[model samples]
Target: MRSVLDRGLALYRQGEDLPAEELAKCTALAVQLAERGERIAPLLHAWDVGCSVAVAACWVSARPGEQSELVSLTQWSSVGVKEITAAISLAYVHAQKQAGLDTSRRVLADLMLNGSATDELAAAAHHSPAKEYVAVAGRVVGENVPSAATVARASAALTTGDLGLSCQAGRHLCILAPIRSHRSTEELSGHMVETLKRVGITFAAPAGAVIAPRSELAMAVQQASRIESLAGIAGLDGKTVESSQVISELAISRDGEYRRQLISLIDPIVEAPELLKTLRTLYLMDLDRSRTARRLNVARRTLTYRLERIEQLTGINPVRTRGILAFVLALAARDLDLSSSVPEGV
Candidate 1:
């Protein structure tokens, strides 16, 4: 049998020419997937773009000799045609649920990336009135990322009545959902994590999420992405990590320039494995010089010399609160493995 997306759109006629039954299949499948905890955003998004192209093709195909306008815009490739047809199938599905709801371009673009939601997205992005909003960003370990619409649909199932939206956004699976007034972010976050796990999600790292006001959904997303990374590094693999759980890392991470400065302080030490180990161990042991020396199995004088050398090179003494904070933050940043990808944004 032809896929739900391609079963129709054949023998192109005109925009909205696709049959109601064929289009309805896409909608039915979307709802079904959402109910069963599958991702649907990417699938619907594919449908959106695909259908838009298909209609454009149908419009041009009907024009025939008057195709000059259509020719410039379309590449006329087989893949391009297939994509547009899929989109038509997707749009028809939406038309089924919301009648004339277009989802608009703004919603589609936002869903295609891992970021926050802006006020503009509310119109077509399924905004609902709720006391809390949680934005999720997750990626499967390999190429087997679930279809977009399938993931989105899965997210919606969590709403259990409240307004929710979920979808595959680029490499991440995302959700924008509301919280009941009685539900705490921790409860919601933990529940979502467990739910995703129960559904057998094959994420490389567990999902990351942030719950906040609608106005900060975008920043929440960025924070969630980082929390996911930090959790992975902290050995909390395959568990949902929320922003509230990592306050210090979140604070240290916010300043792009300050993070760089902290990292710079450790660069000179990095070249010397012994010195790196010394300072890292010192900080890791909570400034216990005796314990650090004993763990390294070095004499007191040797430990003293290494500390002096670290101070000489970085000019930051580990004994001082400010200096130790900087040292620990730098290593924590390294431990989180964000030394490179962090600067690029979520």
Candidate 2:
């Protein structure tokens, strides 16, 4: 089998033609391994090692000082490695079917990794690649990490009809659900939080966003993960936030220069702790002057005076519509650690 792989690789290097028989043998080997309950990772690793050896030998056996031939070998071997891996994947899927094993997990993994797989396999898994999905991800904090059964039970409890697949990787749990089924991502997020709480697991700061399509579940998961991180930075723990609500803040959270520039909006009054507190409280109170004043233990008139002073110092009103947006973003950027010491009197 190893010799077969080497021969196929060499033939490809020499003539850019992959031998059909060699690929068939690889497929057969993968099927056999799958049927025997052997993992595909080790088999793939062995194939990788075999490819490395063949490539090295080909390079060494090149004619003396044959730089062009060596370069060609490198390129061809790279292509061979990918083709062989794909072949193995298809073969393993075939083996799973022949053995009457559930291939849904494998199908999901393939989609997550490559964003696409054979349409037939996807159909078998009931995960149509053409459909759109919403990805909800949350960080599982504390020692009581939910077990696989716990995760499944919680997911089943929260979702109905077509339940999307849930993947738990270490401290992170991501679920990709059909968009049509779950119209409101926030509702889905709330369901997740509630169900997780019932399982003795604290789902901290779950975040969600609509992804492009079922094939892009991985990207959606990544987006949800980023949202969760941003929520944490903003001290929004135990809250379920949709990306759309904080899209601008999320964008600013990514760029250091933008964060610094936005945070600088409040630099003029950073030294005045009282004014800063007032501004933060105003926003937190949803710009309700009466509530903000009560929270700050100040009279409404005092709160009014602080807002005027804030506008005078920073040139941006903390209560007006446009000014409110800018100040909120600046506060978010600062909370995300874009802090700098503005001179005391600036």
Instruction: Give the number of the best model, judged by lDDT.
Output: 2
**Candidate 2 segments whose C-alpha is farther than 4 A from its true place:** 1-7, 11-111, 116-130, 141-160, 169-171, 180-202, 233-240, 338-346
Alpha carbon lDDT of each predicted model: 0.60, 0.67
Question: What lDDT tens digits, residue by residue, belong to model 1 across residues 214-300?
Answer: 656656776777776666654454456776666667666666676677778788888899988888778767789899999999998
Candidate 2's displacement at residue 278, Å, is: 1.4
Mind giving the per-residue lDDT tens digits that candidate 2 earns over 38-146?
5565566566688788778877777878878778778877876676776677777778778976544543443453443455555555554447766666766653344
Q: After superposition, how far is residue 72 of candidate 1 from its true place, in Å?
A: 32
Error of 1 at 102 (Å): 18
Model 2 scores worst on lDDT over the 10 consecutive residues at 337-346
Ten residues in a row with the worst lDDT in model 1? 111-120
Off by over 4 Å in 1: 1-91, 94-131, 141-165, 202-206, 214-219, 230-257, 285-305, 332-338, 343-346
